[model samples]
Target: MIFPCILSGGIGSRLWPLSRKDRPKQFLPLFGGESLFQKTAKRVNHSGFSAPIVIGSNDHRFLIGEQLSELGITANSILLEPMGRNTAPPALMAALIAEESDPDALVLLLPSDHLIRKEEVFLEAVRGAEQAARDGAIVTFGIKPSEPNTGYGYIKVVPGEEPVRRVDTFVEKPDLARAESFLKDGGYFWNAGIFLYSAKTMIEAFKTHQPALYEGLLAVMETRHSDLDFTRLDADLFGKLENISIDYAVMEKAENVACAPVAPEWDDLGSWSAIWTVLDKDEDGNSSLGDSRFLGSRNCLAYADQGLVSVIGLEDVMVIATSDSVLVAHKDKAQDVKHVVDQLKSEGRDEVDRHPRAYKPWGY
Candidate 1:
């Protein structure tokens, strides 16, 4: 069975005033009705796929369980970390646990929050990467670049066939000029952060590339135990491990790295600007949600949760409103919203960490 290891450990500070620390963007229902997490859970519930193994925050245990329950889906396990230690440890833990059950089990690691419009194409890519993964290749899915997006990291892949190819190198998010250069260069693709590899294969890669981290995580796993519906990692031991992303920990340094170039229409939904782009707009390029209206507004996005929001003669603006706070930003300056969140955090503002309506085990 192919295991889906869903990573759900982000605060999503970028899309703040709407997305908060207590309830991140993944849990919010931005689209039709289903939340992004629920949508992701439904996407992978296909033939040859097993129940997902969710790696999420300890505080979000109830939210995770409740959301999965709403869809009549159950996870294989809910691994709770004492603190956020990035992707490497939980990824290693999932592989270790899967290795115990079946060393050859394919682990498909994906983010909990992402928009994938084309399910069939994505499933095909997953199936396509299975063979390469079984052959000891740590395969990551790459998106065909449509623009010189400076927000996402780029992957350099060697020219090859339809499904998979040798990954040349991974590049950080570049500046405007470098991003444009990459867009001109036909070999670059956006890193989707989706990985597929066999349990034994990934474990070996970790051993070879990040030996110390691998060993330390193994030691922490030995002390792991159950907490009701969650598998709790030993707090003291886990805190001592290095906080690093899986990309820097293993994939970049590993020799058996591969890239599955896919055109599945995926987006990380990372910022307000990204959200505006995906949202349906009117003739004047205006998009509004809740009790919101626009008059003579062009290229403006407005959201109102509690009250009526109206925009008049506004251009290239983002207006988001909740019961407690409202945000008005220029479309080009939407990326700077996180700076506001950072300042709020430094000032010890409650708005930085939570919304007016708090989600709980019982109700919001």
Candidate 2:
């Protein structure tokens, strides 16, 4: 069986105002009233996959439960992390939990905040990589690059006729010139961070490549306790584990790493501009979420949480207005929104943390 493990521990500060510490972008109802998390859960809700295992922040336990309850989909286990420890630990933790039931069970590790337009294509790619995964290869789904996007990391794969190809190397985010060069080279793909591997395969990878972290996670799991519907790991033990990504901890070191190149119209939606691209735009290239209008505006996005928002004679500009905060920036400069978030964080502003109307289990 394929056990889908959803990783939902990111702050998503790049999409601030709409996305905050209390409620990140994944939980926000951005896509026609459904959150990215909900979409991710629904994507794997197939007969071929088992009940999902969610690993998210402890602070978002209630939010997670409420969202899952809304969908009427029960998770196999909801593991709560006291604090962020990146992807390496959760990947291994999910493997460990799945290994308890069946050592050879395949685990599909996914990020909750990704936007995949073509779900069927993505699933078909997963199915294609299943055999490679069962054959002891840690198969990562590499999105075929439509553009030379410098926002995401790149994976270099040996081109072949097989469904899964041997990964040559992983490359960090590159500059525009390097990104263009990668596009020119047909062997490069965007590293989407989606992995398919057997539970035992991942556990052994961790044991071999990251023995210290492996031992530490074992200790943390030993003292895990259940809280309501969530499984809580030992805070102290978890906090002490190394803050590293699975790419660094295992994939880069392992010789069995493979890539399944696919084009599913995938985007991480890391910034407001990215959000604008996926949204439905008008003839004038203007997109609005709530009560908003545009006058002679082209390639602009406006999101109004409560009141009316209007943009006049603007080009490539975005306006995000919430009850408490308003942000206006050029579409090209959307990636710099994180710097604004950083400034707010430095001032200890409440806007950086959450909106005025907070979401709770019982009531908002």
Candidate 3:
């Protein structure tokens, strides 16, 4: 059976007003009615997948359970991290847990913050991954590069079968020149951070590629506490882990790595600018998330909640207002607006990391 493994602990700092530390992007309903986590769950559900196992922060256990209950969806488990140790450990931990019950179960590892508009294409890619995964391959969904995105890493695929191929290399975020050249060339796809593999294969890859993480995960599994839909891992041991990603820990070093193409209109929704791309534009080519009044404005995104955002003749600008902050940046520059929050924190600003209303398992 296809069991989904949702990694919900990614704290996106770029989408500041909407995505705060206490109420991060995954939990925020910035997309529409459903939060990104809920939307990811729905994707797995609509694909006729089995009940999922979610891995998130202990602080978000209540919020997660409440959300699942609200949607009338039940998860197999909800594993908690004491602190954010990045993707490698949590992914390995989830794989171990899944192996305990079903050694051969294919676990589709998904990050909670991505937006895939073409669900059918995504499912087809998953189906393709299923074939490669059964052949002892750790498969990743690689989105065809539409433009030169410096924000995302690149995955070079070695030619193989019709649907899936061997991953030749995993490249870091390139410079402007290299990114442009990558787009000019073919065979390179954006690393989507989505994976599919058997519970058994992932655990073994961890043991070989990341022995330290493998041992750490073993300790967590040994003493993990399961209550309702939550599993609180040993906080101290989990905290000691070296902050690393699955790419560095295994995928880069592993031989049986495969890349499956996804033809979906997908976005990680990592920043406000990315969000603007998916939203409906106004008559002036502007996208407004919340209530706002605009006059003589053209090609601007206004997400106003705190006060009246009146834009006059602004071209390609992004304006976001929250209870404690207002961010107005050029549309292209919104990607770098996160540095503003970083500077705020350096001056002892708490609003950078938190919002007025926080979400919990008991409800928002």
Candidate 4:
């Protein structure tokens, strides 16, 4: 059986004001009516997939359960992380829990934040990945880079291979010159952070690559406490475990790692600019999600909810007016919005991160 494990615990500090501690980007209604989390959850409900298990923060227990309920979807299990110990530990935790029911279970790991829209293409990729994973390969979904993007990390894979490529190396987000060289060479793919593996293979990979993390995970799993439908990892012990992503803890060092290239119209909305690229806009090349009016605007994005926002003579800019705070910045500088957040944090301004209408476990 293939069970989808949804990793839903990022703070989304980069998507501040709209996305916050309690209400992260995944749960927010950013793209249309359905939240990103709900959309991602629906993907695993396809014919080949079993019920999913969501691994999220303790603070999101009610949120996960309640939201799934509203979507008329029931998760098999909702595991609560006592603290954010990153993907490796949470993956291990889910592996332990899934092993109890089906020791030979194949786990399809998905991030709750991405927008993977092309269902047929995405599902086909997952099927291919499952076959490789069944053959003892630690599988990852890699994206065909449309541009030499320095902001995204690259997966150096075997050249000339169509779709499924044997991962050569996982490279960091490089400088512009290096990025250009990678694009020209044609051996690199963008790391989408999606992966598939069997419980047994995952356990083995963790043991081989991240022995300490595996040991700590073992300890945490040994002390795993269940409450209702959720398995809560021990707080003190889990917190003591190092905060490291799976890419560093395992994928970078693992020899059997492979990339299953998926062209699923995917985008990780990490910044405001990414949102603009994914959204639908008007004739003047502008997109307004809620309430806004624009005149003589070209290549602009304005999200207004608190009140009517009218902008004129705006070009290549983003104006987001929330209840507490509004963000107005050039599209090129959208990535630097985190700098504003940092400044706010230094000044003890909660508006930089916390949204006005906060999400709760019961209901928003």
Candidate 5:
């Protein structure tokens, strides 16, 4: 059986005004009152998958629990991090715990906030990567790029006919020209940040590549205690561990790494432009939600929550109107929404952190 380890700790700052610190984008109902986290949980709940193990922030523990409960699902375990330390340490901790029950446990580490259409294809990819993962390979699902997207990292896979190919190299986010070149070059895949590996295989990789992190997280996991239904890690000890992503700590340097090319209509939804790209656009190239209407507008996205929103004589514009705030940006500058968040953070504005309809243990 494969265990899905969902990492739900990121505070998505790019989709601000809608995505907030307290109630991040993952927890919000982005699609028909179903959150991305809920969608992710449902996606991995197929026959070959086991009950999920969630690794999330201390602040959003109740949100995770309540959301899962709402869907009539019970998690295998909920591990609470005292603070954010990126992916490396928490992944290591999950592997260590899984190894306790079964040494050969296959752990599928995925972000709680990605949009992957075509569930059958995604499952097929997971099944195909199982063999490589069992053979001691840390397999990462690499999305076949549909365009020259500069927001995502790139994975250079070696030329091969196999479903799982050796990773040639991992590159940072490329500029426009470089991204276009990679698309034309045809050997690169978008680093989707989804990984599959056995407990023993990942443990061995950590022991070799990151010995200090391996040992520190091992010790910290030993001291992990259960609070109600959630597992709580030692805050002080976890804080002492190095803060790094799995790509930088293991996948980039490890010899036993492979890339599984998957093109199942995947998107990280990191920005409003990405959201616009995935949504169903009309003939005029406009996407909308809530009470929204567009007139003489092309390539525009309008989201209205509390009232009617109309866009007229606009092109390549995004308008997100919420109960408390509104964000209007050009489609090309969708990624720059974080700058507004930064400015608000500098002024210590609560709007930068959370929404007015805050989620809590009981109710909003």
Candidate 6:
């Protein structure tokens, strides 16, 4: 059985006003009244996959449970991290947990916030990579880039016609020139951060490449306690474990790494501009959520949380208005929203953390 291990520990600060520390983008109902987390969970709820294992922040434990219950889906385990420790630890932790049941079980490590428009294509790619994973290859799904997007990392796959190709090297986010060059050069794929590997294989990879992290997590797992339906890790031990990504800790260092190049119309929606692209637009290229109206606006996005938002004579601009905060910026500068979030953080602003109306288990 392939265990889908969904990672949901991102703040998504770039999508602020709508996405906040208390309730990040993954939990927000952005797509047809469903959050990205719910979509991800539904994607793997079919026959080929087992009950998902969610690894997320302890602060969002209630959010995770509530969302899953809303969909009538129950997770195999909801592992809570006291604090953020990046992807490496959770990757190994999932492997360790799955290994307890079946050492050779395949674990599909997925990020919960990504949007995969073509689920069939993505699942077919997963099915194709299953044999490679069972053969002891740590398969990373790489998206075939439709454009020279500098926002994402790149994976260089060796020339092959096979379903799974040997990964040449992993490249960090590049400048525009380098990104374009990668587009011109064939065999380059966007590092989608998706992986499929045997539980035992990943555990051995961690033991070999990240021994300290492996040992530390082993100790942390030994003392893990259940909090209702959630699995809580020892805060002290987990915090002490190295804060590193799986790419840095294992994928970049392992020889068994492989790439499954696919095009499932994937997007991470990392920024407001990204969100604008995915949203339904009108004749004037204006998109809005809630009671919003546009006049002479082209390629503009306006989100109104509480009241009606009206835009006039604007092109390529975005307005995100909540009850407490309002943000207006050019679509070209959408990525810089994180800087605004940083500035708010520096000022110790409450807006940096949550909206005026907070969501809780009982009531908002």
The candidate maximizing lDDT is 6
**Backbone clash count, each prediction separately:** 0, 0, 3, 2, 0, 0
Worst 10 residues of 2 by lDDT: 355-364
lDDT of 4 by residue, 269-307 (tens): 888888888889889889887888999889998888678
Off by over 4 Å in 5: 359-364
* 2 against 4, candidate with superior lDDT: 2
- 2 or 5, greater by lDDT: 2
**Model 6 RMSD in angstroms:** 1.4
lDDT of each: 0.88, 0.92, 0.83, 0.83, 0.90, 0.93
When summed lDDT is taken over every stretch of 10 residues in candidate 6, the lowest stretch is: 355-364
Q: Candidate 4's C-alpha lDDT?
A: 0.83
Q: Give the alpha carbon lDDT tens digit for every residue of 1-364 in model 1.
A: 7899888888888888988878888988778867889888999988798898899998778889998998898898999888999888877888987777776799999898899999899999999889998888999999998889999999999977758999899999999899999989889999998999899988888888888998999999888788888898788989999999899999888888999999888888988888888888899988887888999889998999888999999999999998999999998887899999999999999997777897643555
For residue 92, model 4's alpha carbon misses the true position, in angstroms, by: 1.8
Report the lDDT tens digits of candidate 3 across residue range 234-348: 7777777889988888889999898997769999899888888889988888888878766788878888765677777778888889877788888778778678778888998
The model with the greater lDDT, 5 or 6, is: 6
Off by over 4 Å in 6: 360-364
How far off is residue 144 in model 3, in Å? 1.1
Model 4 off-target regions past 4 Å?
A: 358-364
* Per-residue C-alpha lDDT of model 5 across residues 108-166, encoded as one tens digit per residue: 99898899888789889999999999998999999999999899999999987788999
Q: In candidate 5, how many Å is residue 208 off?
A: 1.2
Tens-place lDDT per residue, model 6, 131-217, is 999999999999999989889999999998898999999999999999999999978999999999999899999999999999999
